[model samples]
Target: MSKNTQAPIPDSYPMTGGDGDYSYSRNSFYQRAGSEVAKSIVDNAIQENLDIKTISSSVSRNSFYIADFGCSVGPNTFTVVQNIIDAVQKKYQSDGLSSQVPEFEVFFNDHASNDFNTLFASLPPPRQYFAAGVPGSFHGRLFPESTLHIAYSSFSIQWLSKVPEELFDRNSMAWNKGRIYLTNAPNEVSEAYAAQFAKDMKNFLDARSKELVAGGLMVLTALSTPNEIYHFPVSPEFMFDLLGSSLMDMVKDGIISEEQVDEFNLPVFLASPEDMRRCIEKNGCFIIERMELLIPLSSINAQACAMNIRASVEGLISKHFGSEIIDELFGRFQKKLEESINLVEEIMTKRRNQLVTVLKRK
Candidate 1:
């Protein structure tokens, strides 16, 4: 079925995985890094009875419905879904209703153009939930009203619905000429990105509020900047800066046109807690039960980090610049990153924070 809003997103490149020659499936250390955060959320939700008490006897032969929005290719997804289901079962056991445990239905959602075939093929066996794929953008309605009990998104909400149109208009004050994201950009450029994020986030909250049952739970983990800072020290924006610099290097080498760099921009934003809270409060359908920021403690090797970043964005770069230059570009990226190991290590130690929030349907 079609989503309520058919927005035009640059769908040419998804993260490198599944159908893409570069496998995010193989290089997804970032997803793995996020699994512990997701598991912790499920555990806390269970402790707080986030969705357990919401299960109504109104629906006969009740089944627990859980969804993972922006569920990329497998591996980490399997782990997270399993953790949630296990928590639910434990809750039932504690209530002495183990035998009456409801059937489970797990939905994996992402862009319609996502690699569903690869996602399904890699599903782990001895499944506790009846899994299904709901192909649509989460920024709009994807399910029937009040049908979902739990909705979870991990490291995914950072992506905006689309690049702001102002970024492309040469006459506009927000024209981001050399860079893709808002980092080091002018106030107008930052404002354009923020506006896009606000619009997309409002749509996201509104849609989810409609889909979730009363007292249903929504947990989201996303990249975030601190309250006082406009930019995250260890954000993908930094990587974009590096990529942008690398692209400029190629421009100097006469490898790619400068016009191409001028035309390209990523459709993603890292939100601040204040912005997130404001959006949630503005929606008025959900109450924030818990919010916390988590930073990865262990630092990954520079080369490994570069590969992980490549797996997540190589498709985007390759789509703009020909695939032929992929190796050269990333090779340059790795060397550039490696040379600054001390700085990268420092950033990784403090790292950007992941804003983990649990909201209860009002």
Candidate 2:
């Protein structure tokens, strides 16, 4: 086995309650917006033939192996697969190769901790595709060498591993007993996060290079920032601090253990275009095909956001605010959303464009 040295796993992950625990699937805001974004990526790849290679004679049609990395359960994956099929069919028709449909092998991969039972149960009727559990991180190789033709990962890979133990020293009072980095994390925190991202991205590419044949295409869509700020979305420090404060409040009130919070790592990071470009260059086998910035509309409204939050954070809320406070928490969050809708609209108008990139392996 290849030696792996990522961050430690968080306790809050591998969430309990199975499929029901992640009610985000049911939220229309998340589903619809995600589906639209995914469709655009697939369509762009096919039209551009991002992996086309020059031939001395006639161009040989290559077998297409498509994998949806970090594919979670439910309609999002299905919708993307359908769009890919449509794009392929359109390409074949345009090329005047109507005798047969191209052979495609589709794979759905997520963390082993994901609810495979729920995911597999909801899959579409089986055809010429295979489903396998990929337990390790996508930043590492999950398949054999040069076997992939196309790869896609959406809204995943943002979560970092739990903070490494080395970040804390025994004498640090800022340490919340492993609950979080000292309230005032050392200046190295920013560099540490960026370094991890660079390493993870490099691993992702190195693995992909080995798994993807020459002239393979990959379309990657993830959350990114516009400028080179230490924090993603122009407020990385603020967001982490806010979430840390929330988690710490729960710990102070005896809702969750300090160790538990320490173990829980948020799966979100904002990458700027420069960061993305640098990672691509480091990979050494991919060339940029297309890039765009977009902000998708939420599938759910304020009401549904409230519900998903309740389902996701209810346990934490109950621990801190007591079971009875659940309803109140939801109400307050929703009210805040409603009140800030105008401000959100204004801010988003300026930042609606997020980043999307299409890359081809050399």
True-vs-predicted CA distance for residue 206, candidate 1, Å = 0.9
Where in model 2 is the C-alpha error above 4 Å? 1-8, 11-22, 51-63, 126-133, 161-187, 230-242, 248-267, 298-303, 306-350
- lDDT of all predictions, in order shown? 0.79, 0.59
Residue-by-residue lDDT tens digits, candidate 2, 1-362: 11222234442333222455335456434434645865766686776764333210112264556788877665577677767767866766666665555566678887676666777787777545555556666777888877776787776655444443333333333223443432245545545556667777888888888887666778777766666543432322232444465556656777557655654444344677788889999778888887777766533244655554454445544544356645644565566546655544433344643567788878
- Give the residue spans of candidate 1 off by over 4 A: 1-13, 19-21, 58-60, 228-236
Q: lDDT of model 2 at residue 354?
A: 54
Please provide, for model 1 over 193-241, each residue's C-alpha lDDT reduced to its tens digit, 9 standing for 90 to 100: 8888899999999999999888888889887776636484465467667
Query: What number of backbone clashes does candidate 2 have, counting pairs of residues 3 or more apart or in separate chains?
Result: 14
Candidate 1 global CA lDDT score: 0.79
Assess every candidate by TM-score.
0.93, 0.76
